[model samples]
Target: MAVQASPQTLAPFLIEPRFVPRVWGFDDLRPWFDWSRFEKGREAGDPLGEVWLTGDDCHIATGPYSGKILADVIAQEPRAILGPVAPRVESPLLIKVIFAREKLSVQVHPDDKLAQKYGDPRGKTECWYALDSQPDAQVAAGLKPGVTMDQVRAGIQNGTLEDSLNVLPVERGDMIFVDAGTVHAIWPGSILLETQQNCALTYRMYDYGRPRELHIEKSLEATRLTTRAGKVLPVSRPDRTILVDVEYFRVERLPVRSQRSSASLAASDEPGPGLSYLFAAAGSARLTGEGFEPIEIPARGLVCVPAVGSAFVLEDLGGLDLVRMSPRWPAAI
Candidate 1:
């Protein structure tokens, strides 16, 4: 008999399309050649990367959660989830699959204070994991070599800022770290996973003449005028063991060939609460928790474990890439 999967609170996945017309459109973004196929100015939806799996409202792209929303289920038990379930009912992390057909806008994200000031629902801090990429695919990261913040501001004023930005080529399996206030944009011909705080507010510094109007003034105010400390380095080869660790959350890439169970990351006695978001990028997996139904997550789908009692196991049907994200970090701001 097949091994019975464990039972746990399983929630649906969400995908919100950011369709824009222009030089930055996925059509233009497609030259990055990160995905498998495209049909002239159009991309498929069922498997779009930027689609969010388990977010608030659970409506953008709903599913059979099989129980209450993660936030609600967590109320009965804290350890059931991996991180602190906040009063706001928002998951600390916003996970996405990003398929770039063209370069995204040159943009900067705001910190919490500025986010609230600007009426943004969440602060944006994100990281990228390249699933595929074309030979010439590249990403715009930080400033060009030797360019200073003052020089950047001057370029903005003189319309020569593009020259001051650093562009780097990328390939499949590459990882990029993007912090709030970091000047960056995704280049075309690349497919990747983006894990970030649960915020959608973006301040674009440049749009390359897309039909959408640029947010220059807001971008100017939100952007960190001072150049960031380090060079815009890309993590070409990340140890799947530790992919990206930030103040908000942690994203790890785990591949399972057979069946694997989740190792306990924290003990119940641990002080604060936690939550976990499991994504099946490839292949199917079964999720079992203490007080919920055993959920079957198909390839490219995701499930949220709201109140995980003790720990849960991920039984891989065969070959698969799993993205496990959690908010175990204390809020810095």
Candidate 2:
């Protein structure tokens, strides 16, 4: 199945989000989602923990592509939608809002080599940019320095694995990188915007005695005593703040000042063509471009600007705190 985009169809648009139910989720998403717009709330089923912005099954919410699945759209016209320079045809990144009421599983993810060996597409290397955090909120990023794999296995068996983790305090607007092979867990108290490679291969080592299945052997094999997982410092610019730029993706914080005129796309000066994801983390804004109608993004809404589309400008509708994320391919590729 294939769909072609006419001139009228090539415009920045919105994609409906997919909600995932989790035991560690909250009953009321509140500011993130209005229950009135959803099917049902706590009365119907489990609490909602994650709202996936770019899931494969998510549908295009606006323009000529409306009602089409994201994966199918990209598969049909990868270069037109994802940019001619995109590393792969399919979507390269998965963006999600992670809400945790309880701790997540103490787990590790494989790298590209190990993932391919296990018949998976790729590995998971993700970053977290805090949207909100409670006082004293912290996350277990990696193992304590010099903690060997033998000790990690012993701790898991003894139900003392948490003690071996190096817990780091997290605050709002902080960015942390969690590369592959990092033993990590997200505890209660923060809402995180997670950007990662489009892969989900988790090997759980411990789960606080939960009855769920464990992958001790594979986890130990994928674990690293010391990992490149910790807080990330931002590189500030006059117009925006570069949150994190890795081989997978680059995210920046664009603060919309109360201006009389629209502002040009932040990356308009860069060479080559690419796509941009505008995430309204705090307030609403408007996206305008040539050959298309103005698209308005509500608070917490997400919109995609394709490379083949016309040059775009952003206008402040309210106090807009926008985060722009774009994919980054390896230089070797």
User: How does each model score on lDDT?
Assistant: 0.59, 0.81
C-alpha lDDT (0 to 100) for residue 285 of candidate 1: 76
Write down the lDDT that model 2 would get.
0.81
Clashing pairs in 2: none
Query: Per-residue lDDT for 8-80 in model 1, tens only?
Result: 4433233222322334334333332333431222245333334445454332233343234544433333333
Give the runs in model 1 whose Cα sits over 4 Å from its true position: 1-49, 59-88, 157-159, 225-240, 255-257, 264-273, 288-293, 310-312
Candidate 1's displacement at residue 289, Å, is: 5.7
State model 1's lDDT: 0.59
Residue 223 displacement in candidate 2 (angstroms): 1.2
Model 2 per-residue lDDT tens digits across residues 1-333 = 222343223577797777778777888788777645744223566788888888888788887788888898787767677776665778878999999998888999988878888898788889999999999789999999888888898999998999999998889999999989999999998999999888978999999867778999999888888888999999887777889988778889976776322335555545566777789898788776676677878888888777666566777887788888887765432
